[model samples]
Target: MRIEIWADVVCGWAYIGKRRLEAALADPAFDGVPVEVVWRPFRIDPTSPARSTPLEEALADPAVDNALRVCAPGLSPGENRTRVSDIAAAEGIGPRWGAAWRASSHDAHRLLFLAHEHGGAELQNAVAERVMRAHFVDGADIGDRRTLAAVAAEAGFADGAALLETGAGEDEVRELLLIGKARGVATSPTIVVGDRALAGAQPAEVIREFIARGGHRRELPDEVERLRHAEALLDRRDPLGSLVLLRPLLDAYGDDRNVLMLAARAYFASAQLGRARATLERLVGDTPDDSYARHLLGRTLQRQGLAEEAAPHLSMAAAMSPEYD
Candidate 1:
């Protein structure tokens, strides 16, 4: 099993999430489960200054505090900090957040890519642990090359400073960042196994369930590709599979005509008459002139044995397009 974690190095919840996932993998139930964990980059604050700033000063910045607010909505910055600290403490991962600085994770990500290239997932995960600890526990400025080089050496990379100076992994890291964005990675510590993602710091049991659900590797990386894949599943007469792929797309694009139409068709195929009716109603209401939507709505009503309600839509659809009859 390949588990990919998209997270920022400085994210407190991400650190805690890592510990929880480790615990899950260490459980006897998965003793021989051959899992490879790969960490991907996500910058909570891409515009964060390269130079380190005082923890309080960084917290005062809107860009910094906004991420905190996202993690703990309705809580003030101080409250969010306390909440994160408490959660981390419960996970046995006490972060030295008092004097921690907020700096860009670009350099840290680059070093991570280098580690992956050097020794694949094992070396990369080892380096990631050290890097995250350096940021969250030691309060080191991860953006600093010297600090990162030290972390690299600690992770058994001897020529780490030279590699940093040469900027060996810059392009690879940037590409991975773009890949994460393309994959719809919006939150820190988004755990992705295949195309299915569990956002935020989920519990170990939840992570276990997510893993055991058995998802294949990510073949569809973007909205267009995922939509196409869903349609292909529908074509294969796998309505449940199509619905699974469409779930996230529906959440993100519920208002989209194509998405709604596809969902209605999938629901209808799967004998979910109510959902199909509701979706078709919404689509028909939004686009009264859409012959296909009207036709689908009529068919859905007919399926529910509401022939009286289906009459006008069927007539209107046939009137608009003869093929709809």
Candidate 2:
């Protein structure tokens, strides 16, 4: 079966776990019955607001960073603050990350949903990395709708604005928490395999051994504590608490052209005209029958100060749908 991962985009341990899982999956030893990894959202900072500052001082709290290190090892939390942007550009899987220091969890979770819709676990990994890089490394404000939308556009995701406006992930966050409770997850990086519940980042060999056993046993170590504080701290209504869950899955799984066009909407909202134009142009040309594509393309073209050029696409869109302006 596929491997389902419960994690937050901002968690360093989750990143480490992701790398570990990738290594395992790539290993020639497990080549035949390879596992497809699913990145399930279990938001750690549900209450965090957009452009929120670090909880600790400017230097990053050593205690929390140490905790992550215990789970993964050799982690330097502040290091991310320095390298987030360069990493985002190089990785190209995540959105733009610059030094934006806010504690907004909504953007992180929302983009995860977007990535989920694009393909599956593979797409999720790419999407999650992009948004996280923006939040954790770039210090970008994840709380702003424009910021979120811009990041989504950069990552080739759906209109982040529409999803935020519609409050897409509002219910999903609550549901995922419930699932975590039922499964007895207490920490940031707990991974469940069938009945097996893994606490902490854990050693790869230990996780491998557990997986090798067919994952029938669930472990709740004495140190096991569920993820509680992080959620309460990050979830705020201004950005909308219920909204985080909805944001990630809307137009996620990037395979659909319509979704790509929708992502263009977010990009446009975020003022990423170049990418927005590119996405809309590609979608309109590839799927001329899609009225949504024509409409979005027309809007994108008009925004670029090409009203005459946009007229045809707008007309086609109007013809395809009686209500379209």
Candidate 3:
């Protein structure tokens, strides 16, 4: 059996999910099953700086919300930490989250990719475990290449830092990230067993039940349902989640008006101005009379400081529809 886990090293829930998965696999029911687990990248904070501020301090700022905030809204960071720590403690993995620093996980994912290239799945898992431990338990600066190399050394790679300097896993890590996105993996600690996926830090019992289903190809929702779900995510202010669901649709329905519109709206909401502008331009090109598309394109261009270019589109949209005005 094979399981692909999409997660981030710094995500507390992912750390807890790892422990839960281990416990589930350790159960006597699956004693003879040979399960190969592959770790994949999913950046909960894709735009986080390399190593800027302490996690505790960042969480204190209302402006800086992390995956925890996205996952469980209405709870403060301290409360979220307490909730995660309590759960992790029960699972025998006590995380010292207070000591953790907020940093980008790109290098950490790169190291894991390198580990896989060096020693296959076993080595990759080892590197991932050690890296997560370094971040959540030891509060090591994971964004720093030097710190990562030291962690890699502890995970059985002697020249880990030197290997990182070679930039070996950069492309592979990015490809893995794209794979996760294509698979609609919006949440961390998502375990994809066969065709089925269970997201979040699911309980051991729940995970075991899911794994027991074998590799049955689960039925996928139709495109209409998917578009509706993506639109709902946008309404909830979850552009990333919306994009995750829209990725496959964008590929399958690349020219569909509804798909393009929703994707463009999500891109705009997420501040991915380039993507938004491109998608809107495609929509406007396909149907020149689309008032909303013109208006959104104008807004997107304006947001990017192309005011002069936006004026004509904004004027056209207003002339076409009073709502745009």
Give each prediction's root-mean-square deviation over alpha carbons.
Answer: 11.4, 19.0, 7.2
Instruction: Summarize candidate 3's per-residue lDDT along 1-325 as a digit string, tens digits.
Output: 8888899987878888988888889889899989888888999888788665787777776657655666779896678778877777788875354347888999889888888777878888889888888887888888988788888888897766788898888866875675566567889989998777999989999998888887765456677766776787677777887888788899998988889899999999999999999999999998999999999999999999999999999999999999888
Flag the better candidate by TM-score, 1 or 3.
3
Each candidate's lDDT (Cα)?
0.83, 0.60, 0.84
Candidate 3: where is the Cα deviation over 4 Å? 65-68, 95-99, 216-325
Instruction: Report backbone clashes per prediction.
Output: 0, 47, 0
Cα-based lDDT at residue 117, candidate 2: 60
Residue clash pairs of candidate 3? none
**N/CA/C clash count, model 2:** 47
lDDT of 1 by residue, 1-325 (tens): 8999999888887888899889878778788888999999998878778787877787887877887777678999888777787888888875454327878888888888888887789888888888888887788888788898899889887776688899798866865665566567888899998879999889998888888885886454689787876787787777776787788899998888898899999999999999999998898888899999899889889989999999999999999999976
Over 199-274, each residue of candidate 2 has an lDDT whose tens digit, in order, gives: 7666567777666666644445321212221123123211122223223433354455434544566566656678
Off by over 4 Å in 1: 95-99, 218-325
Q: What is the TM-score of each candidate against the true structure?
A: 0.66, 0.51, 0.66
Q: Pairs clashing in candidate 1?
A: none
